[model samples]
Target: MMEMILKTKQVSEELGVNPSTIQRWVKFFNLPCQRNEHGHYLFNEKHIEELRKIKDQLSEGLAMTDVQIDIPKKEAVKTKEFTLNNEIEKRLDKLIMRIDNMERRLETKADEVVSAQLLQHRLEIDDLVKKINSLENTLLEMQEKQTFQMQDYHSDFMLEKPKPVKRSWFASLLQLFSMIKS
Candidate 1:
């Protein structure tokens, strides 16, 4: 069995990363590691080999998503004012223009709905007018027949009931006197 002996600094130097980064990764990913009686970390040879391969791949310019890290630093911003601002402004303008166009389309759709409703209402009104005209024609024919019947019937048959006969004031006085004498 080959003796496995390596320090944090040795691995850090080999990987071209600070020892703290390796320590953080060890803590975060829970890699297989042992602590000596002095409480110093000891990684096996296989773990060291795996870390070396990962470091090699990263140095060869792999995408950040593929690599495992505690926290990644932001990509360095290129020192330029005009291009960066212009790019942001262009994207913002495009977003605003797209929103405006969508709003206009929505407004047009709403107007079309209102127009359709108005057209429907007009159609209903036209139908109601047609019904009214048909009813008027019916009423005229019925009225003509009603007039003919009225003329055919004797007016006396439809006369109001005659009022009851009323006694004269003198007869009413004489009847009152007779009742008093009795």
Candidate 2:
């Protein structure tokens, strides 16, 4: 037993606990031990092997001297808190991403609506221009017909008029005065 020894770190690793925990147990429980010249605990291999058996027995639901084998309460609480924080962070990230996507979609829909309104307005303007052109053509044709009718009337009036007869100047002057009065 004196030829074999285990360090605190090695013992803690095998026991699946912190070295400080083992140190507390050793101090509080008054575990039988011997210190080297450096004042460090020196444990025999057989002693550690025996402790392992006791730990395994406790793990199998056995109570040694009424000492429960439950994990430390503080560590379990901290672990639960860490898990909750991680879960909340993940959900928050997802929610923010969803909101961003919705905002982008809304912008796209607004752009589409604006584009449709612009297209509708353009179509109305084109239709109005076409109607105006048609009306202008109709007005031009009406004016041309009126001009031709006036020219035909003038030609007919000229054909019906009698030529001036060879007469005294006084007689022609009297006929012109009579025509002006009529």
Candidate 3:
């Protein structure tokens, strides 16, 4: 008579539980399991029967401590180590997901910062343009004032001096006769 050995998946299927759950059960409840040459767990029919009993007890709302199954000390230690390793792996996966989420958020924040800076730069450029326009208008007004002042000065300079009073002919004759008598 050959004993039938089943893999974890097969046992989980037969028991209607997940494979990981089966491993946890094997660890916690100290269900008898044989390790294959490849270091995988193999369960025999007797092991299955023991698992069924444990499952029944659990389904009946019995606490693990109250189940009253004697497990070997060495096997319990091994199971504890396995459970701890599984826990660590699960925690590491969660931490990796958190880090990924944080990186995405940081990228989003950086984009927003760049956008804000661009808007600020645009506003500064607009202000400078307005100031330049104002300065140009002032310069044009000053030039116009200077041109009007120059035209006024030119008109003043061009005014002709009053013509010298014309000499009378009588006055000229009297001056000549006086000179001849002398």
Candidate 4:
């Protein structure tokens, strides 16, 4: 006897919810759902049970991310209907691939964030260097102006004085003799 696989509509009606909600749960929560050859979700009794539990958790005011789920390995039904080892290997491979993809995405995001921070710091340093150069040029100009003013002040005060007259004593004696004769 084969196990009955239910469609999305049937599961939705059974759970009294919309089909889109079931699809969302399967996609976002990685609910163990298999796709048919026509690319439609094929949910077994166990998958439906899991969906019911998810609905109950949501109804109890639990956040979607906080709702943890554990998917158990598929076991042989009755007379070894399927090879247990092969199924385990396939599931393990799929899980490893998913883990690798997540690792790559995390590394890429971290690198992008670091690069953005470095670029911001580089731009800020460039602006500061420009401001420093501008201030240096202003100081040099002020110093040059001060040097020129000092040179002009010194030239005015360092000039030579004129010599005194040399005939002062002879002129004084002649004026005294003339006064006596008068």
Candidate 5:
């Protein structure tokens, strides 16, 4: 089977590295490559494997100068997976923050609604209090009028002279006797 060959751009994409880095790797690390007619470097699977090994060693805290190109056991790249997970976490965090903001806004709106209702109730209470005061004042005026009328009736009744009562003849005889005695 023929080996699959890829251009510099394709290698850059596969390695998740810059095309310049791949070119530098070709020059500095002596990365295996074939020159096309245009003198552009073409990479094969072997070169990709060696790049993966170098990347692994770099990730393991080895300096670029210290990294060896010899292929270790083949393993999947962790950077891509790590990037995806990081992105997902970031999105979830944003979503959580948005939800929290919405909740706060809803709470504020609810508080405003309650405040408005309370204000309306207070207005109603104020109106009721005013009406009650008006009624009380009217009642007080009515009472004052009734008390004046009672006082006037009482005074009028007292102003009238009482009629004299006729005494019995026996009571008149007793009175005449008493006058004689005096």
Candidate 6:
């Protein structure tokens, strides 16, 4: 069976807690959770149960600092940025293809109302496309920032090879004689 993973927003809604509060809980409680490449929390059902228990405890006057979280040890999900991008792109492509097919079918119907509705839906899809573009841009910006940070880290911390000292012929001969005597 495929395991289900919930996003932060979904988890918050499920637990009837504010999203920010949930984020704070995750931070303060050190809840073990998976994060997407963009650093968004990807929660499993166990996380939801844990959060619910935490919420109940807090509601019962338990101190936030006193409450402890016990997340079960599990392998983390490996959802890389490129994989997410490819999946989203594939879904968008399918949606566009469906829209194109619908448009083609609607063209033969000769119904003005249906045509207007299709236009509205197309506009909505265009809005989605714009949002996807904005998200892609954000991902690109994040990748650029990470690259620059890594570059800075390497520049600041990387070691260089020391240059060999140049010696005159007299100095070399004296060192050789001293070694020969020894």
Q: How far does residue 74 in candidate 4 sit from its true spot (Å)?
A: 25
Q: What is the lDDT of candidate 1?
A: 0.71
Clashes per candidate (backbone, < 3 Å): 0, 0, 0, 0, 0, 0
Q: Clash pairs of candidate 4?
A: none
Order of the predicted models by TM-score, top scorer first: 5, 3, 4, 6, 1, 2
| Candidate 5 global CA lDDT score | 0.81
Worst 10 residues of 4 by lDDT: 73-82
Candidate 2 whole-model C-alpha lDDT, 0 to 1: 0.71
- Judged by lDDT relative to the true structure, which candidate is superior, 2 or 3? 3
Model 5 stretches astray by more than 4 angstroms: 1-84, 165-182
Better of 2 and 3 by TM-score: 3
**Top-TM-score structure, candidate number:** 5
Tens-place lDDT digits, model 6, residues 1-182: 99899989999989898898788667656677889999999988888888998899999898665565665434322235534554565688899999999998887676877888999999999999999999999999999999999999888677756679999999999999999999
On residues 1-182, what C-alpha lDDT tens digit does candidate 2 reach at each position?
34768888888898997777566445433456677888777677655764566567767885443343233454223345444554665688899999999999999999999999999999999999999999999999999999999999999998896877789999989999999999
lDDT of 4 by residue, 1-182 (tens): 89989999899999999997888677656676888888889999889988998899989998665665656534212222223443554588899999999999999999999999999999999999999999999999999999999988888667756668677787989989999999
The TM-scores of all predictions, comma-separated, are: 0.38, 0.38, 0.42, 0.39, 0.45, 0.38
- State the lDDT of candidate 1 residue by residue for 1-182, as single tens digits: 78767778777887789887677546433556777788666776766876776577668896323555332234222234534554565688899999999999999999999999999999999999999999999999999999988876747556757789899999999999999999
**Over 4 Å off in model 3, which ranges?**
1-79, 160-182
Query: Backbone clash tally for model 4?
Result: 0
Q: How do the residues 101-148 of candidate 5 rate in per-residue lDDT, one tens digit apiece? A: 999999999999999999999999999999999999999999999999
- C-alpha lDDT values of all predictions: 0.71, 0.71, 0.81, 0.80, 0.81, 0.81
Overall local distance difference test of candidate 6: 0.81
Count clashing residue pairs in model 2: 0
On a 0 to 1 TM-score scale, where does candidate 6 land against the true structure? 0.38
Name every residue pair that clashes in candidate 5.
Answer: none
- Mind sharing the TM-score for model 4? 0.39
